[model samples]
Target: MPPLNYFVVESPDPVGKDAYERIAADVLQDLDLIKVIDRLHIYVDPKIPLFVAAGLLRHMPRAIRVSDFANVNPGEKEIVLDISEEAYLAPLLRILWARFGKENVDQPDRFTVVLPAGVIGQKEIEQLVVADPSETLYKDVIYALQYIAPEGFKVRRQYIREGKFYYVASEDTLPGDIVERVVAPLFEKMGVTL
Candidate 1:
């Protein structure tokens, strides 16, 4: 297991119990994992900044290890992929394009692509790029993840300062305990008894 990292998210409106469940599902869908530790925590302050979310994200799972999001099939002389989602498709395509020539790559749809054989496992295919040098592919994926939540949610400020993270959504402030109470029951409803 890798070291845990914290995340802070803010919304422009009061996030109710239903909203919390949606957010949790989105997180799970984005980062599919077998089991996340019980240490996970979420804080929702619906006072000034409308809504705020802060918590410790334990053992962040790898994108490729998640599910069939990126299917790699060995073709006669190439690797065919049937990407059903665009959330992480850009980065995957960019990395593949860099390895195989532009001519060797083919995009049949917004969510599908084909790559030459030499690039299948010959090079390092990064499942996740924390920071992208090109800026386009990386930033797009990050933006997409942020938008996965409901519409009312507006990201005010996200900071990973020091070892702790703080995210302020709107312009209001609420006690951290309140946020915890709001999310607790939702977790239980999601079958996370803890």
Candidate 2:
């Protein structure tokens, strides 16, 4: 199992606690999020029909840009891009075409791209963001939480803010003070503030 600085699943029933531990572990692993989660605490109170998950995330990598995998250089008549990794070729091309019309951008080969002179500056091209891992990571975390929650526990609240993430769900309308009552205490157990 990948290391999570802290992990716990609490329930009034010991059997239910063990089952939730297994389910949460399997779901986090399946979504490839075990390493990204620094600490986690899940509290399931079936008697009250409530579930809460509080967690802190590790520092995530920054966005992917053209310069990360390609080289931009000046050409006699145009700007040339020498791509080193093919994985980003498709997305790189899409961004270029949208920013500078397709007429101004041309790809002559699998790993080469040409842009008309004065169309865009080399520095600007290098900094154009192609993908942001944090954006996708937030979405993935929400999906994983939803999967871990008990079935029919549909009413939900989720947050990804300031290096922290939280999820709360219930079959009935949640109490107005869930954050102050249940969520805050759970995060306190992990040495984090919600």
Candidate 3:
């Protein structure tokens, strides 16, 4: 396997939940070559917020492509979708509903949906609204970072470019050296040497 190239350091500020989701999506899109190993962990201390992410560098999973997650099946009057393992559930459902009409689609669970017959092709679903194509993925990543941070902490961030992921926590000012020292022993104890 390639050497691990992504990191998730804690942020200095707190961010809302929605913002964090967007940031995670954006980062996955921007790095375009990284696979998120796990969901981001946001911890809110009384004064500051922290973030931790771990993953391998790779392309993000495609949202519109049927193969990306859902399997489309043509039924007599509706299209049945088996989306058991797909991650982008919300956006996919939104797009499907918008294209097929709210009344035409039925979502009984997180992993299954029924689309009316009139809208069974890929083109219709692919046209669903998404984040502006012109917008940089980094902006989304930052938004996600903010969302993932605690509501009280105030900070922003960018992609994890180098081996060391960067972060700015809060006005309180925690030094980078101190963070490294603190994390080092913990990683060492866990038998993780980077």
- Candidate 1 — which residues are off by over 4 angstroms? 1-68, 122-163, 166-194
Off by over 4 Å in 3: 1-64, 122-194
Residues 88-190, candidate 3: write the lDDT tens digits: 6676767666665788779887788877776657554444443332234334445545554455555433344322232335445455564455434433443
Writing each residue's lDDT as its tens digit, candidate 2 over 75-170 gives 779998999999888888888888888988889998999998887788988998988889989999989999999989999989998789999999
Give me candidate 3's TM-score against the actual structure: 0.38
What does candidate 1's lDDT look like per residue over 17-130, in tens digits?
547646654664465421432223344445442443333323334435213365666577876777765676766667656767678889987866777776546223324342
C-alpha TM-scores of all predictions: 0.37, 0.92, 0.38
Which candidate model has the greater lDDT, 1 or 3? 3
Rank the candidate models, highest lDDT first.
Answer: 2, 3, 1
Better of 2 and 3 by TM-score: 2
Residue pairs with clashing backbones, model 2:
none
TM-score of 1: 0.37
Name the 10 consecutive residues with the lowest summed lDDT in model 2: 185-194
